[model samples]
Target: MSRNAKINTLLLVLVAALAVLPLAFGLGDHKEEPFTGADAEAETAITEIDPDYEPWFSPLYEPPSGEIESALFALQAAVGAGVLTYYFGLRRGRRQGEARALARLRAEADADAGDEAASERRRV
Candidate 1:
């Protein structure tokens, strides 16, 4: 193998070894200890919550029933489809406008060339 290739391989290996060495050696002496009185108190407080409190859902405005849930899903899908369709339509219209502008410029250039040719012919 070439010297450069050997050097690159050695560098890559060195980086990988360096990266792993810290992670391997950084697992420094972990010694487990029993939880203290404060830890026990905190655990107890968490477990002692009032049972009567109503749970809060992730999304608060979720529909409760089958029909309502289906309607909400359908509404969301329709809105998404509408937005996509509008965006695609706008993009398509812009492309069409650009094509029209290019065609108009080409036609004007052709017309100007024709006029220039006619004027040259008259001068002769």
Candidate 2:
């Protein structure tokens, strides 16, 4: 109904389309392992280019299975999202509080000025 609501709805639709279009169209069907991570793709490319290539260092801690690795990645993403959400929410609350305080101060000042004017007229 409102302008902001319309905009937000449009944005949500666009995000959903972006997420769904690839899967709906089978974009990764050509790949042997579709939806693999960039790291795995990079490793495949490197090995293809140079058979003797070796990594400078291995991961300090590797997950026991792909499922565990994906779970850990999701957990990391969720934590990062939570931190960002908290930070932004705090900033917005502070800004709204400051704005309300400023409005209250202005209203008080205006009321004081009106009282002063009325008192001056009464005295005269």
Candidate 3:
């Protein structure tokens, strides 16, 4: 295959491996809750270290269940990804537009120079 195609395929494979390898190997299998968030783990650790510890503040809003909390987290991630995608797309489009404008300007200048040369030849 072509160089670019090979590179793209390699990147796709690497991304898939990154996503799959951790799950496949069960990297966090030793943990009590393998898929638990860091916040929950930290809370457990803190409470274990200090039984009478009290929080200075609490969340303004809390989801009713773990499923809802996961859903909200996923939604937040999706929104963040969308925002980043939009920003990058906008930047790419602007770059393409600027490149096209520069190319058009160069072509016009060359054409104008050619026309001037023809006119001078006719005058001579």
lDDT of 2 at 52: 96
- List candidate 1 stretches off by more than 4 Å: 1-65
Model 3 C-alpha lDDT per residue in residues 1-124, reported as the tens digit of each score: 9999999999999999998998899998997768777898899899999989999999899999989989999999999999999999999999999999999999999999999999999999
Can you give the TM-score per candidate against the true fold? 0.47, 0.68, 0.67
- Clash number for every model? 0, 0, 0
Ranking by lDDT: 2, 3, 1
**TM-score computed on alpha carbons, candidate 2:** 0.68
Could you tell me how far off, in angstroms, the CA of residue 107 lies in candidate 2 after the best superposition?
2.5
Which residue pairs clash in candidate 2? none
What lDDT, from 0 to 1, does candidate 3 have? Answer: 0.95
- Taking every candidate in turn, the Cα RMSD to the unseen true structure, in Å, is 14.1, 3.1, 3.5
lDDT-superior candidate, 2 or 3: 2
lDDT for each candidate structure: 0.82, 0.96, 0.95
TM-score ranking, best first: 2, 3, 1
